[model samples]
Target: MRNLCMKVNYDGTEYDGFQTQPNGNTIQDYLESAICSLTGERLKITGSGRTDAGVHAYGQVFNFHTESPIPIERWCLALNAWLPRDIIVTDAREVPLTFHARRMAKRKTYRYSINANRFPDIFHRRTQAHHPTKLDVQAMEQGLAHLIGTFDYTSFASRRSQKTNHVRTIYEAYMTVDHSFSRPGSDDQGIIHTYITGSGFLQHMVRIIMGTLLEVGEGKKSADDIPFILEAKNRSKAGPTAVGHALTLWSVEYEENIKKH
Candidate 1:
């Protein structure tokens, strides 16, 4: 059997998530079924990240081992044929037999989008989280600065989450907007996109951080008080997490050597 690494993009609106669940339809289930249908070989696929329902991905990574003789190009066409319309196999390729998609991943980038308008737009409503209050980038950036180094993030993580270690080092976190109003259908509705890219993330880590920043923007929480929240070791200290619909796994990066022959 040969191991293969695939770069897939999916709209998570219709699926449960990336991993295969007992009964729910998932991205993995469709990919694996497509592979089986084309190659007549049942292979279980593993993904780099397990996003929540309604969460989307542009460059999510997954790996599978199979003895199928289907060409890499045909893999994409064949998989897309049987898979649902929302989930598409953008790229398929052969990789080292030992390459494990989840374990070998070095870093991942996630983008959470928000519509700052009081009235939500009908067209992009599915992807952007709608919030009435104007989110100040300057204030939010201030709170984001507080999340910069390694610290005990117990306050920034979900209380019921199964993760033990609450400490995580954030390489970088920034909030920016695409101000190009020249594009068609560009009302310049103000899309607030938070980009958080790091070596690793704890459960709901990015969402927690986004909530904390939102608090600062709302004036309910002071940017200067961010340090105190981190020390509180209580999840309640942080603001409410943004919905999964706005979160998207942008990409995964890893060492070329780890790609397994």
Candidate 2:
């Protein structure tokens, strides 16, 4: 059996999530089914991370061991041919026998979008969350600058989660305005596009961070409060986590020696 890694993109609006559940639609089930049908082997596929329902992805990854001798190109071609419209296998390549997709990843990148305008755009409605009022851009920048570096992310996680260690290093995080997405009868005046890349993310981490930063941009929270929230180690200290629909796993960085084509 050969371990093959694949990069995938999915519009998570229709499916339940990445992990498989009884009677629920998931990415893993689809990939396994497609691969099984194509290769005649029912393989267990493991993803790099689990994304919540309604979350989207531009470059989510997974790996599975199969006995079939199909080339890497056929993995993408055959899977795309059989997979549903909401999901697509973008790329595939062979990897070392012991390389695990989730374990070997060096860093992960996530992008969040917020439409901070009154009018809603049809194309962006499914991807970007909406905010009623205009945000203070300067204050938003201050929060972003303050957020740069390694710190505990306990405040930006769900209280129901069990992970005790909240410390996570954030290499880079910043937000920008996206003026290109325009819909009929809607004005794209101040739509915000926020992208954050890091070693890894805690459960619901990006959304909570986005919510806290939004509060800071509205002048409700001070930028200096970020450090205090981190120190508090309380989930309730941060703002409410945003919805899953606006978050996307943009990409994942693999070890330098991993085969890439």
RMSD of each: 2.9, 2.3
Measured with C-alpha atoms, the lDDT of residue 91 in candidate 2 is 89
lDDT for each of the candidates?
A: 0.81, 0.83
Task: Tell me each candidate's TM-score.
Answer: 0.91, 0.93
Instruction: Score candidate 2 by lDDT.
Output: 0.83
lDDT of 2 by residue, 47-118 (tens): 988888899989998998888888777778888888998899988988888989888877888999888767
On lDDT, the candidate that comes out on top is 2
Instruction: For model 2, give the 10-residue run with minimal summed lDDT.
Output: 180-189
Residue pairs in collision within model 1: 96-260, 96-261
Query: In candidate 1, where is summed lDDT lowest over 10 consecutive residues?
Result: 180-189
Error of 1 at 75 (Å): 1.4
